[model samples]
Target: MRIVKVMSVVLCSLGIAFAAMAKDMNVGFVYVSPIGDAGYSFAHDKGRLAVEEMDGVKTAYVESVKEGPDSERVILNMARKGYDIIFATSFGYMDPMLKVAKQFPNTVFMHCSGFKKAENMSNYFGRMYQARYLSGMVAGAMTKSKILGYVAAFPIPEVIRGINAFTLGAQAVNPEVSVRVVWTKTWYDPATEKEAAKSLLDAGADVIAQHQDSPGPQEAAQEKGVYSIGYNSDMSTFAPKSHLTAPVWNWAPYYKQIVNQVKEGTWKAESAWPGMDAGIVKLAPFGPMVPQDVQDTVTAKQTEIASGAFKVFSGPVKDQQGAVKIADGTVANDETLLGMTWFVEGVVGTTE
Candidate 1:
């Protein structure tokens, strides 16, 4: 009887230990749009779900938080609630996140697609331009009008770099192709974005690509019977007939890495820009309309990119004014790419 009682006591102690360990970690995410938007925030929410799968870790998120003061309030509240790690997934949240990090030294902060950092804050973004360039190759091959339209969110370096890369890739496949840009200035407004796509369609664009958070552009392309490329996630389901491909984010791997680092006590504040090689970004599968030849060519280029054998921003790259931005035999470095504020030669748009 005494031996059985001692065994029960040992089991009770193990249960208490397990409960303590389970309460050790809490992670929070702040999103600029609702997860149902099926775009950028949806992709980030997938990453948060991945983090939740880890043992002894719990995750929570507040979505549709505006980028300015709303973001700052949400982040500060999460920190105050004892969230060990907070991820603010939007470019405009950079300054606000930096402000919050100063007050919470023990909490880890990660901002997406931004350039600012603090002692307890880090910034991260995927090299999505590489995949965008590949999608442009597909659009260039299929376009009969040789004119592609882009629905852009903002004129920040991230959007500008993607436009330049897409243009370069299209030009590589079809040197005669040109891209037109229309800015919506709002990230998740469907009506404005669809109107922008319609304007591009009216301007004789046979193919449309977008750096936006809504499927509105895709819907516009479909209604017009034109081809389109998507962003942030695979949007084929929205416009299967029109979607040729997309440059998508796979944040699970990177998010898991960060969570593991924090749990292991080895995390530090640094900028992380993982690319195709790291499986952080990729080109979505081709639609049925994409010819086998085009698919094969894109796949070959994707392989080269993944192996680091080909750099997307290799020069003799020219600006919209026919002036050289990157000389021949030179590959554009991260600093140049990060601060890009001008369009490439084949693009028709004002940076402002």
Candidate 2:
């Protein structure tokens, strides 16, 4: 098949368009980790499945390609191979994706967890902080030590905003609660992630939250007999007894939306950060460990958040050193939240 671009109309699997035949659109996925990792990358792969299951969409993915130079090669190869749309699923893939996108303007490209946007390019990510905030609600009620730990993956604003949301949610329920942070700086290094969790557990934390893809923190929490929360996917399998809840991403809906738009000639640049209402962000099953009352409270708060009546990062916020980050009655908007760099009050020093 020629590596040429499709126009407004999409081909059906049976050589026709939507006349009871499968739509034959080629879609591609570029992953930061393998789908079998059962964490961040796994979730994105699930989304690829969502696309494949669609009537006319066929999906292919390249896994474990590192960022930078390798990313450029990966995008070029996929486009050269005739993939209709390529989805770059890592923050670091931003520059490479942009470069390749310029070269292949006919190909539709989507980058997740990135901040860039262009005519033929769009950005998509969920308001995972909403789920993080809900999980912190459980951590607040369950912690007996009044200390919660967060294992962070990087210092980016996305990660930083999550830390703030988690801390703010915990303190909202328990005034005495303090969050201790440990930045591993590596996304999937099990050893570094586990060591970071161990350090926090040693510091008197009774519950843990994490942005890393591995279940190391949840596993460590189980060993320490403390409750835990997860990211990207439900990690309860790693620590059944220690599980609380998780901030799982539901990219399937978004994928379906974009692909259908592409197949219909209605595609356009769009940015989305949907929360609970939009169903893009969701809370994994709460373990039997969390009490009903606590679950009820979190459910109610989530409703408010979905309805725009509640904001986890509403202003009148402060940093760890007691500096005001958001003045009174001020809410932290998307710009501020995306650029956040400071830890809020109640977090201990960096675990590093």
Best by TM-score: 1
lDDT of 2 by residue, 289-345 (tens): 899999999999989999989988887888877888898897888898877878888
After superposition, the stretches of candidate 1 with alpha carbons farther than 4 Å from their true spots are 1-22
Per model, state how many residue pairs clash.
Answer: 0, 4
Give the per-residue Cα lDDT of candidate 2 at 251: 86
Candidate with the greatest lDDT versus the true structure: 1
Model 2 earns a TM-score of 0.92
lDDT digits (tens) for residues 81-117 of candidate 1: 9888899999999999999988876778999999888
lDDT accuracy of residue 16 in candidate 1 = 30
Q: Which stretches of candidate 2 lie over 4 Å from their true place?
A: 1-23, 350-352
Whole-model Cα lDDT of every candidate shown, in order: 0.91, 0.83
